[model samples]
Target: MKNSFYLILIGCVLLACSTSKPEVVMVTKTIATKDTIRIANDSLDYEVIIIDAGFSSWLDSRAYPRKYHSLNYLESKNQLYVSEWNNRVLQPQLYNPNLYEMTINYDPMLRYGYEVNYLIYNYMIYFQNTNKQKLFGTVPTR
Candidate 1:
């Protein structure tokens, strides 16, 4: 009787262990999209592809010397450069009053996409970094 009870207990333990829940796995899906812009000059038109969505903000954050320029000065300088780049590169009809306000329209249908914005955004950054001057002039450090 003792042996039979032990055998029964062992069988029950084995069954319980075998009946444990199965492991679960989860997967996420991602999709990639592409955008491009055409910039026209007097003699030629150029096509530019944009890949990074955060290019505009990133350009703003990195354009001027953080150690030298205050937050307000940095922002002002970025805006000045953007305005000049816009007049030089983008289609004139696409220029919007909202630009100087720093409230650009990113909708591909309405204005342009990440790429177009970044193209000009980076252009301004390059111009500022190389010239060490804003499009208009230098900002007062405080």
Candidate 2:
């Protein structure tokens, strides 16, 4: 009887452990656009893939002043770019308030006059956390 009771207890423990579910994590944001901007490693790494649109000319015009005036500051640092364009221009219209399709990349170390990039970065962070939570069943503490 004693042996039977011990076996039953051990089996119950194993069953409970096996049946336990991992914690659920939630991703707060979703990246729907391929041109979505992302910043990683505390903004040391930046990538901007602009969708195919007429925005490139606009970005070039706007980014030129920053590039020329802040040459030393911009040099060797990761600069923002469109999907295929090599120049950075800041066209006010490129960041169309009406068009929600443009993608932007940003560095936290650098600030642009545009508020859209800031919004994109925050949105990405939210999306990343939410995604991690979904995958691991728990939101990352970070």
Output the number of the lDDT-best candidate: 1
User: Tens digit of lDDT per residue, candidate 1, span 15-69?
Assistant: 3233223331212121224322223221112223323344334445654333443
Over 4 Å off in model 1, which ranges?
1-46, 49-82, 85-110, 136-142
Give each model's whole-structure lDDT: 0.35, 0.28
How far does residue 46 in candidate 1 sit from its true spot (Å)? 6.3
TM per candidate: 0.26, 0.19
Candidate 2 RMSD to the real structure? 23.9
Judged by whole-model lDDT over C-alpha atoms, candidate 2 comes out at 0.28
- On residues 23-114, what C-alpha lDDT tens digit does candidate 2 reach at each position? 32212222224333222222212222223222233333323333233433332221322221112123435433222222233223333323
In model 1, which range of ten residues has the least summed lDDT? 101-110
